[model samples]
Target chain A: MTEPVTTGTEVPHGGTADKVFPPLDPSTVSPQLVWLAITFVALYFLLKKIAIPRIGGVIEERQNRIQRDIDAAERLKDEIDGAMRTYEKSLADARGNATAIARTTQEKLSAEVDRERAEVEAATAKKLADAEARIAETKRKALSSVGDIASEIAGPVVKQLTGKDVSADEVKRALTAGAGE
Target chain B: MPDPIHQFEVKRLFPLEIFGVDATFTNSALFMVAGVLLSFGLLMYASRGRSLVPSRMQSVAESVYEFVAGMVRDSMGEQGMKFFPLIFTFFMFILTLNMLGMIPGFFTVTSQIWVTAALAILVFLTVIVVGFAKNGLGFLKLFVPDGVPIYVLPLVSLIEVISFFSRPLSHSLRLFANMLAGHITLKVFAGFIIMLLGAGGAASAIAPLPLLAVLGITALEFLVAFLQAYVFTMLTCMYLNDALHPGH
Candidate 1:
């Protein structure tokens, strides 16, 4: 094989180069670090000051709204309890008033009935007294008439039976005395 | 003519040296550029039309977005949304590098420790800075556990601090080691095929088997590449989680 050689250039033929692997040097730092730092700082600040805060604010506002809703519910519950208490008290008051009115009405009706009964009884008693008085007077008149007739009959009998005839007035007086006895 | 490790050598396309630094454009540099350009071009093309019902390209783009988005959300919560751009760029960049290496002549940037270390450091510094900014001196409380007994404070804090500092080291090492091991294994198997075929005669017949193994390992390497990238991002999330809520 004819090998072609270049002037003044020593190319190693058929072997690996002296440098097997690249040198591992710590000094060689990527310049991208500068830009990376800048971007990182800027983004961190932006998020901390603006983006994160906004998200946090939204979360806080939601929490606050929930708390407010809960508080409102508690207040409403209290109001309902108050209203219930008022309703219960009013019911008691209404019941008491109804009972009082019922009692007063019963008493008024009973008193009115008692007065009417007494008036009826008094009127009946007066009528009965007047009738009794009339009967007594009629009885007295009949007895007096019977006594006069008896006296007339007794005067005839006495004249026949006795030697001397008795007077009509004296015979009427004796018959009246016997009838009264 | 064929050596196992020979393929990894960096060759300068344009020979230029500046102050002892080989700033000459190389194959590795070329592939890196290609990876960047390819990634940008594909993403741009995919995202060109904003559609309610996604086109094929848009769907691909959206899928990539959603995959990364879900990872971030799962790992970091809503706070991770802020880091979307960084994590997205990191994932795409590493993914492109890994996929690009599967091409015949392309280089894998993530295989290099320097590159991975740089990325690890970036995440490390970001976590530290963010922790400090958010919590101030309270960031130091991360080293002190809440329920530790008063008598064990010294011992516990020492252990905690050491563990805390090991984050970047482990993060960088895990990616580098995985990539290095996979590439080396692939090269070894590939070298077996070459060595066998070069032996000629009946030995050439056996080359297909090693080649098949290399292919299988390459596929597994591809899975490892994605896993490493995922692990790196997940670790970053965990670190950030610590930064966000220290001592937890």
Candidate 2:
């Protein structure tokens, strides 16, 4: 199996060195080729069956993790949007309720004021009518009393002055004329 | 009488020789050690700070890493990340060895059949082990083409097996042959320039033509060094892809 190495040159006087470093025999193949084949086959199996799959699994897992993170971000965004919408709606509802309450209170206060005014007007009108009636009655009483007292004093004077006249009616007429003068 | 082959003989530097084994350090061993040390030291220094914002050295390191990384990803897909370490190591080692050879007095390890063969064998073995572990007995299906008639299975399987077995041989030979042919051609052309100059007078003026050719070949060899390393790593990814998916 030990072949003479080619020196890239031709020489004349080939001696014992030619025999020692013989040209490689083409007919006789080297066994190293067989060993190389065996080694190659064994290595291929080990890598394909074990190492590649493990590495591939790691790659796939990394991709899956990235995808999951993206999905989680999307979910969080949706939740935040929903919460914002709910908050806005509640705030609007609260404002609407407050406005309604304000309007109702305004109306109630106006109605209450109107009712109180009407009641006060009614009481004042009734008290004014009673005062007017009392004044009219007192005036009538004062006018009748003055006429009766004047007539009584005037009848006594006429009776004494008109004795020869004979009748009470004639005496009353003369007393009225004296009193008027 | 000078032996032409003796020009290629390697000499040891150290005086320590054990049992005529010539264990003393040689030019090839020196370059190999230099390549390994240079690669390790450069990478360590480049990645020392490991900053988020890269320095100049870190940028260079990152570019190399990303280049090889992109190659693996493009050839083998996302699943290729697992093989990053092995693929990166192979690319760096071959690249270092190839580039180191450009320096004067340094030997190119890839020019040797044993070195390239060893690398190829490692890749071949890795693919096989990976394929079997992945598919179990079903890994044998790689040797049997799907959709073939049962009558033709034996022929197809045999061809497939032969082709599969030929990978290491082709892989090794490709690197070894390119490096060997390139260096030899350079040497031969350089020898011409020397021979012409030694003739003296007007003949020395014609030496520039061969000298120019040597320069051109040297540039081409540099390109080849990088190309060969790239091709080797690319093929490794392809084999890894096969192991991952046997029939496909």
lDDT digits (tens) for residues A1-181 of candidate 1: 1334333224321132333333242212222222233333444354345433433344455568789999999999999999999999999999999999999999999999999999999999999999999999999999778877788889888888886688877897798788879
Native-to-model Cα distance after best TM-score fit, residue B77 in candidate 1, in Å: 1.5
Give model 2's TM-score for chain A to 2 decimal places.
0.45
Query: A1-103, model 2: which lDDT tens digit per residue?
Result: 1456556323312222232212121111122223223333433444345433433344455568788999999999999999999999999999999999999
lDDT of 1 by residue, B1-248 (tens): 34444445555566444554445555555666666567656765775655444578866866776687788888778887787666766676677777887666566667767667777888899889989998999999999999999999999999989988998999989987887778778888888998899999999999999999998998999999888878887788788878887868
Query: How accurate is chain B of model 1, given as a TM-score from 0 to 1?
Result: 0.90
Give the winner by TM-score.
1
**Which clashing pairs does model 1 show?**
none
| Residue B85, candidate 2: alpha-carbon lDDT | 67
The C-alpha stretches of model 2 lying farther than 4 A from their native spots are A1-181, B1-26
What's the C-alpha lDDT at position B104 in model 2? 51
In the range B126-145, model 2's lDDT, one tens digit per residue, is 99999899888778888988
